[model samples]
Target chain A: MAIPKDKMLEMLHSLLLSRRFEEALTELCQVEGKIPGMMILCTGQEAVGAGVCAALRPGDVIITNHRSHAHLLAKGADPKVLMAEIYGKRTGCNKGKSGTLHLALPEIGAPCTSTVVGAGPPMAVGRAFAQQYRGEPAVTVCFVGDGATGEGSFHEALNLASLWNLPVIFVCENNCYAGAQRLEEHTRIENIADRAAAYCMPGVVVDGNDAPAIYTTALDARARAAAGQGPTLIECKTYRWRGHGESDPQHYQPKEEIAAWRARCPVARMREAVLALGLISTDDLSAMETKVDALVREAIRFAEESPYPEPREALEDVYA
Target chain B: MPQLTVGQALNQALREEMTRDDTVFIAGEGVGVSIHDNPMLPTAGLLRDFGPRRVRDTPVSEAAIAGLAVGAAEAGLKPVVEIMFNPFFTLASDMIVNHAAKLRYLSGGKSAFPLVVRIKSGAGFSAGCQHSHNLEAWTAHCPGLKVVMPATAADAKGLLKSAIRDPNPVVFFEDMMLYFAPGPVPEDEYLLPIGQADVKRPGRDVTVVTWSRMLGVAFKAAEQLAAEGIDLEIVDLRTLAPLDKETVLASVRKTGRLVVLHEATRTGGFAGEVAAVVMEEAFESLKAPLRRVTGPDIPVPASPPLERFYIPDAEQVITAVKDIM
Candidate 1:
């Protein structure tokens, strides 16, 4: 399938916006208690979120793990509300109840995100099952990464989804790291996608930095899912450019390896991909960057201006 | 009124709710097949009636199945998930504690997880250490969750019906020993309101606060205490999370003495929570120090004789009443 010029440019804008948003959050967290809670940054893995979500329809939902800022942005979440939520402000998406770890923006079909590893897969399958029961063509995309793949829930979700042939797409962001331990140290399996094969599902590995490849693969997977062909596990072989959390010392990861992965930056790669296709110009890319930067700045300003929730409000929202 | 066992009452509730709401469904291990042989045998014939879609037979995956229930409920399905053994709740605690319980609050009240987790708990029939445990305190400690433990068959039927219709995550506890215990349950449609306590046997000497399996022990102890002219008021707390302090405090004020009994261990048990509430609210009414009759702070043993010693009995409750007196 040929990529449209406008959609390609839009994907680039969203990727850049998400990256800039997380970058600002990371910098602010370092300013001596400027930010609250631990922020997990998807520094170099923007292409995976942008590309996979690009293929989703407006009615489709995506279940995301702890590292979810990129997924939310790509799925068309309001940056102001999301930022307000990250800031724990009253007008936030969750009304200041949840910080970055648990975010829910149902308007964009990203109803909720979880902090637990391997949390999204089974829920995504269940969502897809509901859609199937209702006879809707809505697709459910589950974003799995790192320690999530090592969890028993991950395997259970995969096996159940395959058995039921639910309309769920499992996108494994194999970022070469899981907490303080490296991926090689955790699992004997060379690839997370290999487990999908055991469940009788199609498993594909793509260069996560390459936006075009991810978009094409995800688009195909989405189509297969809507057609009731069960799930497809697409492992995006990528790298997390930063530590797991904002304050992680990252002494376990070798500096040379980090520098090597950082060299294959997804944003620069996406810009090249668009340029080679003659879809967008250097000036157009620069303008998109300026627009995204301004939008992120506005979000931060909105977050700052929003008020913190009153202490008494904590007693509410538990039952309803 | 039909005299039904606790298990029969629960099964009746499931059938009634599923009939009323097409979206209500059951999913868990052995729900479809072999649940008849299981300890809490309510889901024995559910699969045959509702078929596989409604009564799903999940794999041995507690954590993921609970997650699946959360998603299903969010997507407009009333999912009743049965975690067969309470001891295995440790496997699914992350889902129940983190996702199911917190989804409503985290979603800013936009999403309601109207899911039911039927957890079987207790130590009897030599179920051994792993299969015998009561972790109601864990659920009660969590916000955004309604915890219910029914002691009578009527309450079981009524509360299960309400839990299914509730627009929040409800941890419905089924005491393993109460499955065969029979009580009068009405045939008419009934739904017991959550967060309400019932005074099983009213008296003026002392208040016995208990629920689930311990309710029986408390009743027997009340009978024994009445013979000695120490009339005991038994208050069954049907719901733990929304603790009904009003009913309990009212009873304590009338009696001027309180005794807490439960299958949970003495340390950090729900008895401590109840006792704390009493001390904080009804301290002036107390004629003596609060007494607690609870299981020992040890895992339920495998041997029948050891298990008998581990479970709190009527004698222990009597002893607690005597101590308070």
Candidate 2:
């Protein structure tokens, strides 16, 4: 399918917004030292989230993993509430109950993002089973890192999805690292998608830095899922530019490998692609960047001003 | 009212609830085929009635079964999934403990996760430690989960009905030994409120606190003690979490002595929690030191004779009560 000029610009906007949001969060964590809890960023993984989420319908549901800010943003979650949540403020999306790792926005089709590796796929199969059982044409998208593929739950989820022929799209963001461990050290296979063939499903691979390519692949997978053609595993080979968390020195990562991935930055690549489209000039792209920068600043300001939850409220929300 | 086995009563509950609500369904390994071989099984004939869409027979994947229920419940469906055995709960603990139990709390109580994980517990049938171990304490320790253990046919039906309708995730424990035991169960639909203990045999000499299959052992001990001019007030705690501390405390206050009995081992057992509650709230009412009659601190033996010895019997319960009295 040919990408439209408007949707292409929208994808670029999402990619830029996600990149800026994480950049600002990194600055707050390292410089100001205000954000609490472990913050896992999708800094170099903008295209995978932006492209895949852009293909989902409004009623479709998504289950994201620990690196979830990009997916939530691409799914149209408000940065203000998301920022407030990471700030542990009362006005945050989960009322400060869930920190960055477990942040979820059900109203925006992303419910129950988990920090447990390889846990999202089984839950995603369940959501898709619900949609299929209820005769709804909607599909569920599950986002997992390549490290998650090693979990037993991931294999169980894939086998069940295939056996039941449920409408779910498994998006594997192969970022070449599971925590500090490099991908080559953990996964022996050349591609994560190859594992899909064991479950009798199509496994497709795409360049993680190419937004349009991912968008096209995800759109095709979603169409197959909604048509009751069962699940499709789409692996987006990408890399994260930052350390696993803010505390890590990341000495395990080779300096040369880091520079190699930085050279293929998804944000810069998407910007060039958008600029190449004659429909938008360099000034238009610059204006979009300025708008996204202002939005990120507003999110930070709202988070800083929001009040912390009362200590007594800690006992609340345990039941019901 | 009609006499029915515990398994029959549970089947009636599943049948009635599925008929009442379209969203309620069962998914588990061999649930449709009834692999346990009990003539009066809860999942018998469910596949024929609800069809495969609702009565899903899954692979031996406990994590997938549990995770599916969590996702389905979040998406506005009430899923009643089976884990076959309680010991296998370890495989599904991630979805059940970390996800289902905490998702509502993680969502800031905005989402209602209505799901039931039906697990068969107790150490009978010589199934050994791997298959028959009771882990109700594991789930009861979690904050968001409601734990239910039915001792009689009536409670088996009523509690299962209530669990299916509950807004939060409930772990419904069924004793494998109690499946064929016949008791009076009401034919009409009824709901037993969770977190309420029932007084099975009321008396004032001493309080015998128990639940699940241990209720039968408590009754036997009461009978033996009653012949000796000693009475035992038996309090069956149907729900472990959201525990009926009021009922327990009330019984203890009236009896002035207490004995906690269960099949699980002594270390970190739920019996310890009961003792703690009495120590915290009704310590002044106790006439003597309370005792706990529980299984030995060892894995359940596979031999029928050793398994029988491993399980705490009426002799042990009676001895515990006598020691406390």
**Candidate 2, which CAPRI tier?**
high
Share of real interface contacts recovered by each model?
0.70, 0.71
Candidate 1 error regions (>4 Å)? B38-40
Query: DockQ of all candidates, in order?
Result: 0.74, 0.82
Candidate 1, residues B1-325, lDDT tens digits: the string is 7899999899999999998999998988888887357534778778888898788888898887888888888898899999988989998888889888888888888888899999988888797888998999989999888999999999999999999999989999999789999999989699999999999998989899999999999988888888889898999999997999999999999999998999988898999999999999989999999998999999999899999999999998888888878
TM-score of each: 0.96, 0.99
Report the C-alpha lDDT of model 2 over B1-325, residue by residue, as the tens digit: 7999999999999999999999998999988886575658899889988899889999999999999999999999999999898899999999999999898888777776899999988898888899988888888999899999999999999999999999999999999889989999999687899989999999988998999999999999999999999999999999998999999999999999999999998899999999999999999999999999999899999999999999999999988888877
lDDT of 2: 0.92
